[model samples]
Target: MDGSEKPPRGSAAHRVEAALLEEIAAGGIAAGERLDETRLAERFGVSRTPIREALSRLAAQGVLESGEGRGMRVAQYSREELAQMFEAMHEIEALCARLASQRLTLLARSQIEVAQAECKAAAEAGDLPRYLRANEEFHLSIYRAIENPYIFEIAADFRRRTGPFRAKKFADAGDLVASAESHDDLLEKIFSANSNIAAEGMRQHMAASFLRVLAAN
Candidate 1:
């Protein structure tokens, strides 16, 4: 039997880093807003050492810009940069879907179907968070079905980085409905075991989402 999962407890540095990342994603720390280590340390009830470490890691991740005297600021992206990021992710995810279609086991496909049902129920109930969680589970089910650890890792990372922004776009009712339809199409293609069709379907789904983001912005 599956045991109950314990909650995560982060170290001081990790707490600071997570809070800072949340601020950035929420737009509380606007693009180019300077990060003051002292202020952040105090706010997070941590020391300067952890704050600095957090800032350094964020800078390395391209989430912040660091300079000798200027300290750090939230990273800014141009429209072109956003487009490029989404385009790269589209290609990667398409490949993932293709592989998943070719290799998905019956058990994995059943899990994906269950996730989809949950998503539909969430939508019907107007539960945004539940819908989002179920949506992620559905995609992840497909990723695991592919059985390529490296590909799954890369796709998961990319999805995590973009998730907050994507969630914002899907807050609209129309977008939510459209997204459900897209998932249906994706699942159908996968069920048919047509890797090429699945790849194309995944690409189109991502393209639609990217367009929605662009339109929102």
Candidate 2:
């Protein structure tokens, strides 16, 4: 799950981080908007110490960066940077799909099925939030089915870093329906146990998504 979705537990810094991440993903804090420590501390009912720690964590995650003067700002992606990131993600995800097509267990396949169903229902109902949630699960199921913790972690981290940009696309119902339909294509390829086909299917899907994001910007 993305840090924002889960119930926050542990230290004050962790809670602050989760809240900030949610705000960033929801676009409440725009790209390149400066984050004041004092303002955030007051907003979250915490102190500067935890707020500082949370900001640092976000910076490390590529969600925030040091600004011109002092504090940090939400990181803005350049067109080239976004293109490059999506290219890498496409290859990584495609490989995962290939591996998953060959390796998925019965339970893993069932989980993917359920996630896809949720996505379809959400899209038909025009529920953006629900569609995004189910979409994450749909992708994660493929990552888990690959049976490689390292690959799963890499995929999860990329998803988290790009969460804000991806969230923007959810506002369009046409895009949401297209995404749900693509998931169906991916599942069909995976279920067929055709590694090459599955990889290509995933690559095509990722490429389409990259274009949508680029167009939106």
- Among these predicted structures, which one has the highest lDDT? 2
lDDT at 9, model 2: 73
Give the number of the best model, judged by TM-score. Answer: 2
- lDDT tens string, model 2, 15-114? 9887777666545566788999999899989889878878887887788988988889988888898888888899999999999999989999999999
* Cα lDDT over the full model 2: 0.83
Which pairs in model 2 have colliding backbones?
none
Measure candidate 2: CA RMSD.
Answer: 4.4
Task: Itemize residue pairs with steric clashes in candidate 1.
Answer: none
TM-score of each: 0.71, 0.82
- Which parts of model 2 have CA positions greater than 4 angstroms off? 1-9, 18-30, 36-45
Give one digit per residue, the lDDT tens place, for model 1 in 53-163. Answer: 777767766777864586998765666877888999899989988998889898888888998888888777777666777777777788888988999867765664555
